[model samples]
Target: MAVAGVLVLARSVRMTTKFTSALDIPVEFVTKNVKLRGKLHHITEKGLEVEHIPISIPLITSIQRKWQSKGLLLVKLAGVEWAPSGMAWLQQELKPKQMIWFQLLGREELALECLVLVNKGRFLSVCLNEEILRQGLGRTVPIKGLPHDSHLHWKLHRRLLRAELKALKKHKGIWQEESYYERLRDRISSNRVVQVNSP
Candidate 1:
């Protein structure tokens, strides 16, 4: 019985070490679809910069403090591409140091494609990806790192399309009509055109 107990303890230690080692590599975490919690650092043209808050594991973390993970992760919203107003909208919606949950879906190079959720109320959470489409601030795009015909890929695609449809119906943001300048320019150009007589 003593030998069995020692074996079990040894296995647990090995597993814990493996998990901690993976934390040190951000790409490993991204490829594994590891959910992370972090504070909003800033917005970038490519995507959001998030300061990752490493998960603390009791005594193990304290001992591995020198090797513990610490850095910003570039996160892009999965299944959506920004429109002209998308960046500005995101800037206004998310504030500095605001706590958010990053549900990683995939990774492309150094950027993690994720579904970013923020607290709406005491018990409510809002998905920023869908909201961006719903407001017409962004358009649906093929989700990277997912198979073209995969079930999960289709599920996310349908949801994003629905959000974009809502914006279209309401004529919001990009869906709205052209500006006055655009209309006036077209009118002036058309009036300047001359008709030629045929021989």
Candidate 2:
């Protein structure tokens, strides 16, 4: 009984432990697919900058400068390459200081590849990766940590592909036809005719 109590206490401590930076996170946590909560700070060309929210443990947190600012985590959405317009869309969709959850998919240098989720309502949470594809604002890419032939990889790939298909079928965003002026410009640039034949 004493051993079980100690084990439970250790697990709780592990769960509540706060990381100072991306490097402070344990490899096992990432591999086990741990989810962390943070506030949306801003979007950059490289990725989303999120301010990690440390778990508050009443008395213990009070001793640890409870009001001190937490460090930012640089996270990239796994399985999607954002388009230029997609960045704009993200800026508009996510408000500053909004609560969000990011599941660690993999780590690359100082940045983390994550599946970013935002609550749309009380019960619905939306995945930004698949949504970007569904909007035709991005293309699906391989998830970094998941093995290519693994079941998890295939499942995620299928979801992303389906989202992309929806956009293709609807002719949305990048899937839409080019304007006449743009098409004409491309044709003129490509056609190098020295002289035109007389009609």
Candidate 3:
């Protein structure tokens, strides 16, 4: 289905005129629909879950400009609500001390939205997204609700796609699990003995 809508980003940073549907509105819509500025509340391999309220405003809590880990950098957020018990599985995998900042990109599906993690004044847009995908944290799905006219946006999109390809080629993260499944299938087939009839 084709639907056209305009979503305004925070501080009037950018405007988007494309959206898929109401169920899966893009980051553009999220910014316009919800509050633009908010604390970076939760982080996981799946996607960052941010609770934006009318009063919540984005606050920068750290000045440490260093990389903490591969494909990840931490930035503290003050006065942010914690993720609920339903997200315990995801929380367990996260480092509570390392609360980073992210920008909503768009929606991938019904419950999941795409985000870009920023670190050291640079956007780890694809790395963070793909790292989660490669590690079997989440599925790599197509996203809509964005303007294709922006060169920068299109560039980021291409980078994300390339990261996924790299993950698949190197058998990193989720690809490793895929390989295991393949091996299991081979073993199962090998154990099956075919009946032979004498000619």
Candidate 4:
């Protein structure tokens, strides 16, 4: 889950194009997708619950300059309604004072018409439409041509982390760099946790 969260970062889309179905009907889509460090809050028969995902220390510091103190959360999602019950469910289940980042992963399926991705489980990746992404954020991500983690150095580091996380989970391996990670991890508790809930 953690690895998926990390891998899913960066390579994301920004809202620009108008969604259309095979019939050329206008459709909605979630603007942006993100997966940050958070904890599971609850679980229902149909959905999983989670909260308080931490961001990379560097990311927050770097993006904080322009984005508001409580960064954008409410975004336009095409073909998907903003479910108040869903948000309220989150508020009730998630731990009080828990802080984490929620990444908007793209639609569940590929087509001109889109459904905002919203998973009810240990982790919830909100499906937001392009309007949401464009409204809250100034950047735009084309649907294609994202820079993949294929460079030699990036691959090597990815491999190393993959191996380490595997070993750590398997047998509780020596956390050689616990102190290093501690220093490197962001202290979201100290900073404001932004929940962008606007369209």
Score every model by TM-score.
Answer: 0.75, 0.83, 0.44, 0.22
Model 2: per-residue lDDT, tens digit, 1-199?
A: 9999999866665566666477877898898889998888889989998887767777655655654546788889998898898999999999989999999988888889898999999999999988988998988889887778888788988998899889878877777643445678778866645235324
Steric clash count of candidate 3? 3
By TM-score rank, best first, the candidates go: 2, 1, 3, 4
lDDT of 3 by residue, 3-41 (tens): 222222333222221112324334545544231322345
- The TM-score of predicted model 1 comes to 0.75
Give the top-scoring candidate (TM-score): 2
Whole-model lDDT per candidate: 0.77, 0.83, 0.41, 0.33
Candidates 1 and 3, the one with greater lDDT: 1
- Output the lDDT of residue 53, model 2: 75
What does candidate 2 score on TM?
Answer: 0.83
The model with the greater lDDT, 1 or 2, is 2
Q: Considering only N, C-alpha and C atoms within 3 Å, which residue pairs clash in candidate 1?
A: none
Error (Å) of candidate 4 at residue 39 is 11
| Model 1, span 1-199: residue lDDT tens | 9999999865444434422222343555556666777788889889888876655567655665656455677888999898859999998998889989888777777777888899989999989999999998888999997778888789988999999999988888887753445678888777666333323
Model 1 stretches with alpha carbons more than 4 Å out: 1-32, 178-199
Clashing pairs in 2: none
Better of 2 and 3 by lDDT: 2
Choose the strongest candidate by lDDT: 2
**Regions more than 4 Å wrong, model 2:** 64-69, 177-199
